[model samples]
Target: MTPKVSIIVPCFNHAKYLNECVESVRNQSYTNWECIIVDDGSTDDTEAVSRTLESDRIRYIHQENRGLSGARNTGIKNASGEYILPLDADDTLNPLALEKMIAVLDQDPDTLIVFSDTVTFGHTSKKSNLQEKFTLKELLLGNKLYCTSLFPKKYFDEGIVYDEKLRHGFEDWEFWIQLISTHRKQPITKIDYPVFNYRSHPETSMIKEITGNTDKKEFIYHAVYEKHKALFHEFFPSYISLLNRKTFYEKKLESIYSSKPYRIYNFLINLFR
Candidate 1:
């Protein structure tokens, strides 16, 4: 028998996109699944909308405003399946996502996690590499793995979960590190084309937080290193070198943008366009 997949959809103030999100789960070719929608203190019509969608296969759970990490933790704790897929409220999965990822998990005993490439929709159409393997160095540099992916619920039982303290963003990066560090030899596999659709809102708090808040960014960066310093110790020198280079390039770009000639060139180009 095929293993059951429990998709945990965490909804905040996104009542508008709830249907489309749930519809993606219903469309899954692999049908032995249940969707647990954790309404993280949504002030919108999330409850009413959830009520309309609820059935034996689908469930609704409400919690206080505990940010993304807390919401995901709640849904996961309540999940009742061998496999867990964390699907955000706004994003969606391709119909073949469950079928394809589950096949990978079943075929290989070493494989515990399965994810795929990302298809960005809404404002922009783009394909992003969500990383084909889990590497300590790669993840330490940046998070290529997205939040929505197929993982086992066993990890949660073993006490691997998202850190609620890093509330704003990049929580997944931290959590992924913890998950991968425990099982470094087992590489994370990516099936070629079963991509999840990542909805790019024209404006979002996450975008603003990442772009504007340097302090928070620095906090999470240091926090990850501090928490997993043992894993990153060998590559600390190289990581610092890369960080310094990135800072220098950023400053150089800022200078170019501030230059009068560059401004004039941009203005002229925009006017002509």
Candidate 2:
């Protein structure tokens, strides 16, 4: 028997896209699945839109504004399927996504997570491929995994909820770090082709929070670093040393760039160019 997949769509002021998102799930080629629509206190018509779509396989849950992590946590808590797939309300998955990712996990008992490349739409149209292989070291530097990855329900069962405190952005990235580090570090599989469609828009919460606020971005990065400090020391001690050295040089360069002598030198160099 095929394992059932629970697709959690967490929505906040994204009612317009909810229909399309749920429809994509409904159209999945794989038959064993359920769609859980979680409305996170949207001032928009999210509740009404969600109410219209509830059915046997599709269920709706409403909560006061808890942000993305909180909304997802609620959905996960209510999900009954063996596998969990977090699909943002604004995004849609390919028809074969469930089928392929489920196959990967079913075949390999050692693999704990499965992700895929993404196709960007909405304001921008491009195919985003995974530039590097998935490794703990690479993942620490930056997040290559989308939030819509497939994984077992044991994460929730074992009390692993997405960190709701990370409201700024990269909450998913932080969650991934926590998921792999504290848990028994299992192998992850990434499908080569794109199985997810990401909608990129100016109003997107992540884009708005991360744009033009360098200080906030740094704060989030440092927060994640602090949260997973022990994991870093355990897995990539050398990389931690390199990061500290890089920070020292960056501070030194900032001082030099602000000095009158370095400014004069830079002006002269740019004049020649």
Candidate closest to the true structure, highest TM-score: 1
TM-score of 2: 0.85
lDDT of 1 by residue, 1-273 (tens): 333888999999999999999999999998999999999999999999999999889999999999999999999899888888999988988998998988888899578678888898997788886556556777778886888878888988899998998886899989888998888888588889655899988876685777577777767787887788787876666665666787689879999999999999999999999
TM per model?
Answer: 0.89, 0.85
Error of 2 at 260 (Å): 19
Whole-model Cα lDDT per candidate? 0.86, 0.85
* Model 1, global lDDT: 0.86
* Candidate 2 deviant stretches above 4 angstroms: 1-3, 183-185, 235-273
